[model samples]
Target: MGYVVPVRANISSINFHWQSLVRRPMPYEISFRWNDPEAMDEPRANVSYVGYVPRVESVFSVLFPCTGRVSAVVSVDIMLNITTYQPKQAIIFLKLKRSKTCLQGQPTPLNEAANDTVRLVLGGAEQDLSLVLGVTGAIGVTFVTLGGVMMFYVRQRKAALRYTALLSCWSLEPEQRPQPCDLLGWMQDLSASFDRLI
Candidate 1:
């Protein structure tokens, strides 16, 4: 028999299986109990099958249904009832342990025996970073470009203000005021002298 329950977000499902090593057909019933007392209402199933080979064993697998996110470690107690030639029934308990990461499609073996638990790992949803990176890069480039334009504009305004102040100072001396053409020629001479000195 088998039991099914909701698994955590990281885990997609759990694959549980058992094998009968006995030579004859064995009637078995399996039940599951969770560590959490609140999850007492777990699903269980029964099976009746026989073992034909001595060393070889038949494997029976079941998937545990996953529902919501599980943050803590979940411990499951497996109880098995095997009916043999004797009138009395034999009970066996196998402990299955699961963590949040184990459910992410990674196959985890519970026991060393070949008939023990084998988990199947499921891949989580992939996140797209291309769009986010593109947008961020675009914003950064725009900000840098805007800062450069503003700096250029401020430098141009400062230079124009300095030139205006120099012109006003020259105009204040009415007796020494130079003609517009002479002023242009004087500015060119001053620039040529500065360049030669440099």
Candidate 2:
């Protein structure tokens, strides 16, 4: 997640709070880089917490030049880096405030600012794997049931067609009728075909 500041507004300071929810003590770090598409390359901003620490609440008062034009909106990219092996979660709160001089020779206060919070989770792959397997098994069972129903429908259609053909043949005149032995042989052949299909 990222935050956008107003164009041409001076970014005087950025404050952040980092907390870890791991039972055992572990080292962690946070840093951010500026991503400007118009520039040749993104430049990294220096914050206070480069070294590894368990938890930190830091503020950076470095001057950030607003390169955005009057009518265009520019964004800054902030990235956080955490180093830990065990399953853990962290809550980060960030605030960006600016101060400037007004037309009446007055210094505006830092009343208006951009604020954001983020929650990071790490290492929960086992639960995800179980969920995926459950969904896959359900899909497999659905497809197998659908296939059985389709096969049953096809068999019924074939039997109906054979019966219809027999009835049409029997409707013919007596001189053109099929013999009883011939009808019996045809029925036997149809049964054998159905057995083979099944």
Candidate 3:
């Protein structure tokens, strides 16, 4: 049998988020997570209490078998004395299950938003908000450009018809037809005339 990693009272977990858009430091939430509810209800491990074996490293782990479930439980140990701030901690028990067939013992699902999972939205403070917003805006622009390119490619098969129609109009000389499309306008000043059809 494997041994449980120890947790102590003074010891705590820390998560920090910095948002550059609003130039602010988001809230820092500290907490705990473990494989077994029984094991986590009362933290058995902390800074002072080493487990069955003394580990010189700053980090330790405890693994839990999930039976036939898709996700595995995990516990990571860290020293509590290194941080300046601490907060109230709470544990959430998740009993919700998957509707589709799930593989046994897969890694935990950690998307940006997942129910019954540990998620903290954090970022920089007001001073850094501009930076964050800059990055976000850049990303938004890139996505728009990509979407436009995709739309163009998807419509490429039909674009030939539109191009052919325009060519037919421009091919006639101004003198040969009634109100011919001003070819000189296209050859000399395309930008001014192109706006009509665009």
Candidate 4:
């Protein structure tokens, strides 16, 4: 018969102790596995040992690999299998214990380098944006300059036309004076030009 044991601890190392009930040596097999939910197809850690037990008790320890320290309580399972010549032929005893290790400190060099790379990329993007804004500002200024020049040329042309109309009306001979309609048209043109200039 076998039994399942539930263990809860902040574990870093697992120690296993077992002994045979009989006074003589015996052959045994022990397996240890760590199950991870993220990887259902395969366990994260698997260890197996097959050897003969001496008359005295046997003790062994397995250190689980960890990238960093874990503070939270975790659950794990321990399984031990034994073979004997006959059923219930040998007495057996198993003991399991957990030990904790502390690893807390500042950021590692690799992490610092990664953070610096991210900052550099963001800085480069900001500089590129500034350059684009500078170009856009220059284009806007050029457009404003062209608009002012166009307005100046248009005003000058209108002023010249107004002066020429006034001179033509003055130089006409008394008998060659414009009809009432022609005079009215010239007056309307001069009034519009003055309005636009003001």
Best by TM-score: 2
TM per candidate comes to 0.31, 0.36, 0.20, 0.35
Off by over 4 Å in 3: 1-166, 170-182, 186-191
Residues 120-160, candidate 4: write the lDDT tens digits.
Answer: 00012344567679999999999999999988987887777
TM-score of 2: 0.36
lDDT-sorted candidate list, best first: 2, 4, 1, 3
- Which wins on TM-score, candidate 1 or candidate 4? 4
Error of 4 at 121 (Å): 3.2
Candidate 2 residue lDDT tens string, 121-166: 4332455577679899999999999999998998898888678878
The C-alpha local distance difference test score for the whole of candidate 1 amounts to: 0.45
Which segments of model 2 are wrong by more than 4 Å?
Answer: 1-122, 189-198
At residue 169, give the lDDT of candidate 2.
78
Go through the candidates in order and give the clash count of each: 7, 0, 29, 0
Predict model 4's lDDT versus the native. Answer: 0.46
Give the 10-residue window scoring lowest on summed lDDT in candidate 1.
119-128
Judged by lDDT relative to the true structure, which candidate is superior, 2 or 3?
Answer: 2
**Candidate 3 C-alpha lDDT tens digits along 67-161:** 23432233533222111111323222222111112234442222212112222222223435675698999999999999999878756734654
Model 1 quality (TM-score): 0.31
Q: Point out the worst 10-residue segment of candidate 4 by lDDT.
A: 114-123
Order of candidate numbers by TM-score, starting with the best:
2, 4, 1, 3
